[model samples]
Target: MSKKSPERTPPESLHLPRVGVETHAHLDSREFRDDLPQVLDRAAASGIAAMGQVFLGPEAYQANQALFDSHPEVFFLLGVHPTDADKFTDATLAAMDAAFASDARIKAMGEIGLDSYWKDVPPETQHRIFRAQLALARERDLRVVVHSRDAFAETLAVLDDMGFKDRPLLWHCFGGDEAIARELLSRGWLLSIPGPVTYSKNVELARAVAAVDMDRLVVETDCPYLTPEPWRGKRNEPALAVFTAARIAQLKGLSVEDAWRHMGQTAAKFFGLELPK
Candidate 1:
């Protein structure tokens, strides 16, 4: 007898218990350029109701604006990434100001924070750009998605000195431990956890997730990256957010439905976006 191949599961086979939103993802990435439409279609099929695309560069900003204009469900965040600190020119700031001033779909300024992972960019330069963007977010009265890596202490110090207490700040793809979680929570900052929380070896993340209050938490894929377990190393999409929600739910002792609802509400409130009925 011939051995039979396993049955292939349909994309829709992943049943999501409740609707959720991806607060930060890079759909404008070159990785998704060719199959963007199909990726979004799969996301919708997986019960993703809303998505926030991070605009890392001028090109990404323009591409993100076009994507949001075409897809009402997709939103945008405008900012220069930490790795691109050198890219912040006067013209770039002007473009960002224009986007903030005129674009209703652009919800926040983000994916902009300190990253000490590379020594090529001096810490002073990172601080300068981060401070500038934080000030802009305050002046514009927009929420911010912060991307802190290996420089959380410095990042938090700058935010404190800048008086970011009144502004809504979210730590995107949070990789901190429980101590950092407590500190951020004490300051009323939101933690947006990615799919890495689902990995068994990510005990630190799970502990941090369980330690933080649910009301201050959100979910994201950070897609085309951090693909999560079961889908690791593959091109991640908003549809894969369900795995993130499920993992968080498991950590928090809440049902997947409740976790989804909590994340959707928290994101809506923070980004000032209306949730679809």
Candidate 2:
């Protein structure tokens, strides 16, 4: 009989130095309402030094911002998602602007961009909302986190047209080919690698990862979504960011600790965060 292979270590066991940052997460979602504190504890134990919590809109921001009042490690990203483009009215923009002005924890504006995957919102409306938010980011002098799904060409065109070239822009959940990666790099934007890179069949994304400059790359779990391999079917939490970082290190031919540390530093700088001493 063939000998059984030993079980792989759980991601939480990585226990790397507290130098990694999870650049994106949706901890406010109902999925994490229970035991959110435990989820955060696991993330801290798994080597995550900081985590970015994305709030979908002004109301979500207002409703959930208090949840993290005690967790100083959790920063915020606020914006109206493209799927809800119809709701991105002038008042929405005003509220977002006020939030930026009022809250120091709100470090950036985004997860805002075009999403062709969902047709609920018309293309023109998505474009208009995207531009509006991008303008807000510029006016607020904050970094931009972009979300582009099945709308790469249009997204690129829009960013370029808006003079975002060589700006402090990060492409969140980047799952594109080498060519797409190179184009974004040439434009002087950073790419946030998500859990999808760990999927065995994601050859295109792997190629893109290998081709990216490590300094221009950061890692994100995007959890409670895009859980990495070995935990693909399960609920994803910030603790699983270690798995994504491990894969990025593997693809980039570096030590996991080194990858974790570098990605944390890069993301911290991108969001103007000073990691706890």
Candidate 3:
């Protein structure tokens, strides 16, 4: 009989009781429907202290309301993504308001900036919904998670028009260069570094990681997408956020423990999250 090969284990650090939280994720995505419990357990084992499950819109809110309760380690941010701009309506806003009013589990408002790359949603329509959501966030006294892609200038302009400067903003999966990072930092915005930073070809991202103030740093998997290196083509889960944290540590000249703490604690404070002490 042939001998069986050993299963490969993930890269790990011996840092005691590490503080690694996935600041952004999509726990309700169909990707986790089959084995969410297993995924969350694996994340805990991988040193994930907490995670934020960002809701896409009304449909996502309906499907995801109970996920945060199921795991105390998981918090949520509710908003309409730019792709779902067409779904923004008075009824949807009512549902979002009810979600915030009824449940203290929801933390912030967004993942709601602009995505010009997917042109099917017209720029005008996207601007309208995005601005409306920003107004709602301000009215509710909530922080904002901004997602800008292929429309950086326009996205920045829109936010500027909305007078979001000096507001509590978390720039999700920041893909900009150091210049943009500097701009965001000047505005007192936090950046959630994602898995793409681990890629060999992303030198600029590495530079941005090094350039940003550590106080403004946080980590996220943005999964079931942007799976980090070594797991590039596979679907990602929150457990894998440690790898991204490790990469950030490598770039920032921080020990794995320190890097994890900076990112995780930054997120905790920004979202007013409560992780087990």
Candidate 4:
């Protein structure tokens, strides 16, 4: 009989925080459908003081609102994803506007922007919807969470053309290198790094995170996806945010506690949330 291989275990640091918050995660994801309570419990136990759920559509927005209402510790971002650009309509924008108008817990307008990775959604349509959402955010005076993939230049151009200079913009799951990062920093946009930074092949992203100023940086899990190493290919959750924080701490030459504290504070200020006393 062939010998079986031993199961790999995560490092001890995985369970210990140096400091962390999961700035963006999707609690409405099917991966957490069965054990959301348990997931949130794990997040709290893991020292995650706050979490932002990215709402993808009307259904997701409603579901996330209910979840956030049930768990005050969880916050949310309201927006339509670029892949769903074709779904944009007068009715849809009105619904989003109405939701933002009434929902105080909905912190920002995002996980919204351009994604040229999938050709299914045309670039022109994505640009149109993104501009519309930017306008909504400006009108509502809400911070914006942006998702730019394989269309960085165009994304920045739109922000410039739409005159979003004064608004607080968060570049979620940032994948660009130092040059792009510097450009964003110059424009006063914040960057949120996810689990991909921990992967061996993502040195460029890791460097970008390290190069960014702490005050302008935020950490995220982008859970149910981009699971950090050791847990790669496994379903991710907010608790995994610690790993990303730990790696960033290493890169920035700061203690885990300092990194987490800074990220938590930045997130709170950007999202206009009150930290638990």
Candidate 5:
């Protein structure tokens, strides 16, 4: 689904009786520009203690770097998104290498993987770019956030081609079946669930979420995109992650606190991220 801005303001901050850590969000998106402070506050007010952001371009990345400096509670995953694969170049990769070298807040080189579904960029070019970034992530010993669409099998082959030993590889906005989830689990990869699981028509995706081992599960909003239910049509934000966490709780038969604790710890361990001091 294409990303869009939500029209409603933050719902009254619900006390979720849990610590919701948003594993993925696009705080850098233009959607949040006008009311960025309100968005961040609403997230905090709504019980989202921490959030991980995916940086798509220089403009967004630069803005996020500034946000990180100003808000230590916010962390990031930096990389050229698959849609922007055409922009990948030797110089850009070099600059990214430097950023990875210097920045400790960059938790992963991410939101990077194959996207045959869109196919905006040529397959060959995308492969080259994906492999290059994978190499960089491996070299830096950083976690890799993958965004695979209808290209899961092909993505798996590419990942396998690399010496991708048990590194922290997260499949963000996971929209796969149980079989796919099993394969990812077998590879010792983690899956980040998004707001769509709350939708009624997504039984297969819901089953996948239920099938995911607690240790391998993390929650995401993919904000400015998949806003959770009760507010499905509204624009997504970090605060709404609580609903996703709550849904996981319902599916797992655990309390929201338990789900958040497990998912939060799993994400923190995988990304080597820490709660803000």
Candidate 6:
């Protein structure tokens, strides 16, 4: 009979300092409806100092912004996802604009780029909505968070056309190779590394993490999704970002704590949040 493998260490047992930032998460999703308080506790105990809670649209934002009322560590990213291009409208933009104007925690205009991975939305419609959001971000002078999937080329073209070069933009959920990393870095954009980097088969992402400047790299769980290795089959949470940081540390030849702290600091600066103490 084959021997059973040993159990992996729990994320809290990693003993990472509370200097990690989870740069992306859909905490508002119904998956956490039953036990969000516990999830937030786990995230805190696992050393996550702050987290970026992404609201997919104006409705989600308005409805769920109160969920984190007691958890000041959670910031916000508001955007109309490309797959929801059909729902993008003037009213949506107006809601987002009003939210940004009134709320200090809403830090960036993002997770807002082209996603051709699913063909439900037409490419033209996605492009049009993407441009509109980009223009809005520029108008508000807010940092932008981008979500590009199988539409990297088109997304880059749109960003370039809109003169986003050297603007404060972050490429969210970056699973690209070193060459792709270089292209974004060249435009002075930051890359938000995600849980998939911990997958053993993701060699290209490993190479990119190793080659990129550490200052330009940030970590995210994208959770309740993209759960990292050792927990790949489970629902991802902000606490699991420690594993993502651990893998990034291994690729970059740095201590996991250092990687965690640095990425946290980078994200804090990028999102205009106070650095973790």
- The per-candidate count of clashes, in order, stands at 0, 0, 0, 4, 1, 0
Q: Taking the tens digit of each residue's C-alpha lDDT, what string does model 2 give over 1-277? A: 9986545467767769888899999999999998999999988988888999999999999889889999999999998899999988899999999999999998889889999999999999999999999998888788899999999999999999999999999999999999999999998989999999999999999988998889999999999999888788788888898988999999999999999999999999999989754
Write one digit per residue (lDDT tens) for candidate 3, span 142-195. Answer: 899999999888988988888899999999998778988998888778999999
Q: CA lDDT, every prediction?
A: 0.84, 0.91, 0.85, 0.84, 0.82, 0.93
The residue pairs that clash in candidate 4, if any, are 18-256, 18-257, 19-256, 19-257
Q: Using alpha carbons, what is the TM-score of model 6?
A: 0.97
Better of 2 and 5 by lDDT: 2
For candidate 5, write residues 130-201 as lDDT tens digits.
999999888888889998988888899999999674778999899888999998888888999999998989
Residues 1-277 of candidate 4: C-alpha lDDT, one tens digit per residue:
9986534344344555423557899888888889999898888877777788888976678655676567878877889999999988998899899988887878888888999899999899999999999998889888999999899999999999988775699999988899999999988889998889988898788888888899999888888999876677789888878778878899999988778888988888888877753
Q: After superposition, how far is residue 25 of candidate 6 from its true place, in Å?
A: 0.5
Candidate with better lDDT, 4 vs 5: 4
TM-scores of the candidates are: 0.93, 0.96, 0.94, 0.93, 0.92, 0.97
Candidate 1, 157: how far from true, in Å? 0.5
What is the overall TM-score of model 5 with all chains considered together?
Answer: 0.92
Model 5, residue 33: distance off in Å is 0.8
Against the true structure, whose TM-score is highest? 6
Residue pairs with clashing backbones, model 6: none
Q: Residue 158, candidate 5: how far off, in angstroms?
A: 0.1
Worst window of 10 by summed lDDT in candidate 4: 10-19
Reference-based lDDT, residue 111, model 5: 85
